[model samples]
Target: MFARRALLGLAAALALSTAAPAQTQAQTQAQAQAPNPRVRIETAEGPIVLELYADKAPKTVANYLKYVDRGLFDGASFYRASKPPGYAPNDYGVIQGGLQNDPKKVLPPVAHEPTTQTGIKHVSGVISMGRHAPGTAQADWFIVIGDQDYLDADPKDPKKTPGFAAFGKVVEGMDVAQTILGKPVDPKAGTGAMKGEMLVKPVRIVRVRRVQ
Candidate 1:
């Protein structure tokens, strides 16, 4: 009777071990399938839809959404389109947009969430914050037209090499980005590194809002 009872207990334990994972797996699947937040950027050129990765870059997403909610980006423009000289202009580079640090429209800067921490790289269609230092990123951001993994954090000295905070990607309207990138740029309009990258006539951001 003692051996029978021990075997019954062992069988019961085994049954629970198998049953628990099934339920856990269902919950995990449900969580994984939950959709991320999507935003639509209405531009004079066209519309650009973004899917933000709140799971990977919560703070960054929150910062961006704040601007969207307040309509701070409604009248902003895509002012800069950057690509290396001799490189194919239409195929590679980044397009930057925001209020351009309008004193009234800009908000306090958000903490940086580097790619090393978020696992969000600067790949084609990826959107990342633009900052002079890691923590200075505010409303200004950019979208990569091609893979620019060099923007990812350098693990060697992350403090000095912390990369841009990439929180989302262009899920639709990449053609609008490409079209903006191909627009005319002024040779002496911008300052410093941006000198030649400024669009002659900046593309107007008609509106920026959350997608349902």
Candidate 2:
């Protein structure tokens, strides 16, 4: 009957409409959830490789990747290395490095992801993105020179504003980081995070790439 044919045609049209939308949604999710691209930092001191964790902090890791894939850290020096003021050797330590004078490369601040939600910790050899303000963290990242678990989650927080979210850690060449740490920072040189003539010969990051 013509009525039956009409109903069948309507059903087919409805199915076509619904299926297309579902397929589009699946494609979008796939693009979003793909494994984070790997990044490696090669310093004149040595090469430090890191695997970014995009799943936990997609916005954060994605932000870092934007810098890495764009060659932002290359030719830049590890401008600041801070050891808790007066820590004999390597006590309270965390070394941060990134683009210094290069204005061509820089990213806008992303949301702050603390350890409480991401479950990421500031363990030794762990590399974390550094932010100027609470949510201003971006391309600049630091490597934990000591056990910095205090930077992790705070259970008391409901919003989980615990602290800086750690995305990845160093897999090799920590000695290079140590060497930079031992390079004698001046308090008045206005360089190497100091006030007057520091670094003598600044430690630089020559290149960065993705490793298997």
Candidate 3:
């Protein structure tokens, strides 16, 4: 009976030792998978808070944060607001902002991170980079006003049509984003692809800063 009791006690001790490691591992994993950093974009219209997905798009997030850290967006403005044409819903489009390829503010283009690779999408309130071609995105970015699956990378033909990189989303003040999207546009302010998309009165970005 003494030997049997000793064996039972040893087994219990071993079980606890094993369970403790498992619990610790789970806690470590949870910490590693925690949500990415967040920032506050204070615009003339209002403030928009964004949560950047660093795990999903590390390079893209890093590039964006670089500009944020340097105050590149301090005096930037939302120069364009594209809405759907007649017969289509007006609520579906994007509001673009950032350095706008200004020679002084533009940084070197970052590598493209397609949604296919990052697992992010250009859904409503999601923020994405604006580029003339793949891998040409620098400081310009846009905020989707509605579901925009077409902006997501095409899984079948990623080489030909690598869609825009989506790294973040508006966690608060999406209403401010929508309000900016509803602002008036100049009929003949832009040319070519941006012919009718240019905002008549651009919304100023007062400042951008990291937030807890």
Candidate 4:
């Protein structure tokens, strides 16, 4: 009886010893695979959901979330619908929105997170910061309606522009975004690159909030 008990105890110990490393490894994998944070933008046209790449662009994501948490983006509008000059209205473009430099709501500009550093790209539905120069991004941001690889950082860029800070992508309500893109633009509303791209009736952002 004693010999049988000893054999059983040894078998249990061996099993546990072999399982310990595998269990720890599984836990580590779970932590690494944890999902990124997401937010929903409630708009007059509809809701657009985005999954922020906090892991890739920590500063940009945190800055955006600050605007969301502070309700700064509430009642803001998608004021610009930019398309290539010759392209069809809804075929390819970006829709921009934010506090629009509201003196009371706009926060301090955050450091730019270039695509080169973040490993994010300006692909379809990607959301990126709007800035005149690097590190000047405040509350304004835009969502790409289609792939805009030109927006990605290029070492060979003669202008040496660091490209936009892309932090997230639209996860839902792209149709609503498209609809806004197709809306009317005042013939002479915007300035410079945004010329003729400002939506005549800006799409109101009802609210912005985090989601699981």
Per TM-score, the best of the predicted structures is: 1
Best by lDDT: 1
**Could you tally the backbone clashes for each prediction?**
0, 9, 0, 0
Q: Per-residue CA lDDT of candidate 3, range 120-170, in tens?
A: 988999999999889899999999988989999889999887999999999
Reference-based TM-score of each model:
0.84, 0.74, 0.83, 0.83
lDDT of 1 by residue, 26-52 (tens): 999999888889999999999999999
Off by more than 4 A, model 2:
1-36, 85-92, 158-162, 189-200
Which lDDT value does model 1 have at 107? 96
Question: Could you tell me the lDDT of residue 182 within candidate 3?
Answer: 86
C-alpha lDDT score of every prediction, in listed order: 0.94, 0.74, 0.92, 0.91
Q: For model 2, what is the error of residue 9's alpha carbon versus the real structure, in angstroms, after optimal superposition?
A: 15
Q: Give the winner by lDDT: 1 or 4.
A: 1
Q: Model 4's lDDT to the true fold?
A: 0.91
Tens digits of per-residue lDDT, candidate 2, 52-153, equal: 777777778877877777887778778776766677544457777876534577777788877777777888888887765468776677888878877776
Task: Give me the runs in candidate 1 sitting further than 4 Å from their true place.
Answer: 1-33
Output the TM-score of candidate 1: 0.84
Model 1, C-alpha of 18: deviation from truth (Å):
23
TM-score head-to-head 2 vs 4, winner: 4
lDDT of 2 at 210: 77
